[model samples]
Target: MPRTESPRRGRRPGDSGTREAILDAARARFSTAGFRDATVRAIAGDAGVDPALVMHYFGSKQALFVAAMEFPLDPAEVVPRLVAPGVDGLGERLVRFLLGVIDELGDANPMLALVRSAVGHPEAARMMREFLGEAILDRVASAIDTDRPRLRADLCASQIVGILVARQILELPELAAADRETLIGVYGRTIQGYLTGPLESS
Candidate 1:
């Protein structure tokens, strides 16, 4: 009889299945424990892998969170697009882009997941703050000629986050029922003002 090789007993390292398993485990852990408390060891154990393997694949917990969450948009890519057209109509463009993303992604919006995670978790909130402040708002503020850029960016972020919470998360009847164009028009002016308007009351 021909010698038969023993079949593989478990998932191989660096394999697609292994990666997906890790991601799945990470998602579950993050959902339950939030980013602050979710440990790499725990996630690896959930995936039936070594903690080293998790670090090998994801490099860090933050990277693992990002991978697991599958954020719908990359702010790095979006900031350039928003700033390329000049600051004149940046608010409208931003609102249009944001609404378009929400429309396009619908129930699959990753911002929903992030917001939910950040709501009750301090670490998750910090992650969100850093991501929005540094990646999106800060970059946008830097691209334009303005005073108190950091404050402006933060203000814009507040409005944008509020809109997302009200319309998407809370599902407020008025906001959810409002037309996209109406939202864009109203929010656009507000964001534009934050980006370019005077900081002090005249």
Candidate 2:
């Protein structure tokens, strides 16, 4: 008899395809069910793999989310750099940096995905809140040498998130049509106020 070869079976344990599949599944699950509700088993099922595989590849649900979402920029590194130059013109730098990110990423922006999902899902909203509070807001707050740094950070977040929602999510005509520099100048002033100016009723 001639030699015979057995057919290859399922994907190997360390297959890159397997990893990508899990990531794709995770993105869909997180988008649809939100982070808190999207279980590892469900995501693994979506990817046609075992939940153990998902855990093996991603380490944890939060890590899986961070990987799946894929931010265009890392806030931990970028925020520190932005704040390292001190608070002077920090508002403009911040707005400019954000606009640059949005413009560069365009439709592929993960922030857009986050804001969109957060609108209808409370779980997603909590995810966004925690992410912003910890990653971006807290860093900015700590950098400021002023009273109520947390309040200032939160105020800046409100403005920034509002712009994202208006321009990207709601597609407001005015914001959508406005050029980047124009929006930067307008929003930067307000954000500058929040970051350093007086918060009193005087």
Candidate 3:
């Protein structure tokens, strides 16, 4: 059996011993082997649990990744929330959701970790790109009725990501000091334009 480590970090809302163990294992693997290199079986092995248990608890690799990253949104549920509202003012909803996550999750916010990791670790940056680009943006873009779903998604993704950097990483006083509602409204409109607005040639 592989060595089992105590929960050095992570809180899964209602994390049990086994579940937290799995998360700890996943976090280690992701940090070391990265998102693509890490495998479910390996993570299970590290956790000293059966592969089935990982699936039972987290459902999929992406779900496990999100959880392991300590991100507030549960991949299992966020899509339904984002999908149901359709493309009507999605910018607002998306912005609201991302900001809400940061506000509520606070220091536990994974984006902060992602920024730190991405600075020195190419693997971590790759993982963040794939997770945000594919899991988050691509998934949302696929639902759009526009011609360039990918483009729209990319625009929205960049905007939200920029907000995260400004607010969390740089800690820019203007953005950091801005009222939540006002920031949300301003950013929301830009995000909305990306989702539903017409494109212009530059």
lDDT winner among the candidates? 2
lDDT of 3 at 61: 92
Candidate 1 clashes between residue pairs 3 or more apart in a chain or in different chains: none
Please give, for residues 1-202, the per-residue lDDT of candidate 2 as tens digits.
3354222224566666888888888888876676567799999888877889889887877678778778756676789999999998999999999998988988998888888878778877876776677767889999889999999999999999998889987889989999999989999999999999999979
Off by over 4 Å in 3: 1-21
Give a tens-digit lDDT track for model 1, residues 1-202: 3375323224568566888888998888876675567799999888878889889988877678778879755566678888897999999998999899988998888897788879878777766776566567778888778688888888888898898899998999999999999999999999999999988988
The runs of at least 3 residues in candidate 1 whose Cα sits more than 4 Å from the true structure, single-residue gaps closed, are 1-14, 17-65
Candidates arranged by TM-score, highest first: 3, 2, 1
Tell me how far the alpha carbon of residue 58 in candidate 2 is from the true structure, in angstroms, after superposition.
Answer: 8.3
Model 1, CA-based lDDT = 0.81
Candidate 3, 119-187: lDDT as tens digits: 678887877776776577778887799789988988887787788788888899999999889988999
What is the Cα-based lDDT of residue 66 in candidate 1? 70
Error of 3 at 15 (Å): 15
The lDDT, on a scale of 0 to 1, for candidate 2 is 0.84
Candidate 1's TM-score reads 0.71
Candidates 2 and 3 compared: the better one by TM-score is 3
Q: Judged by TM-score, which candidate is best?
A: 3
TM-score, each model?
0.71, 0.71, 0.80
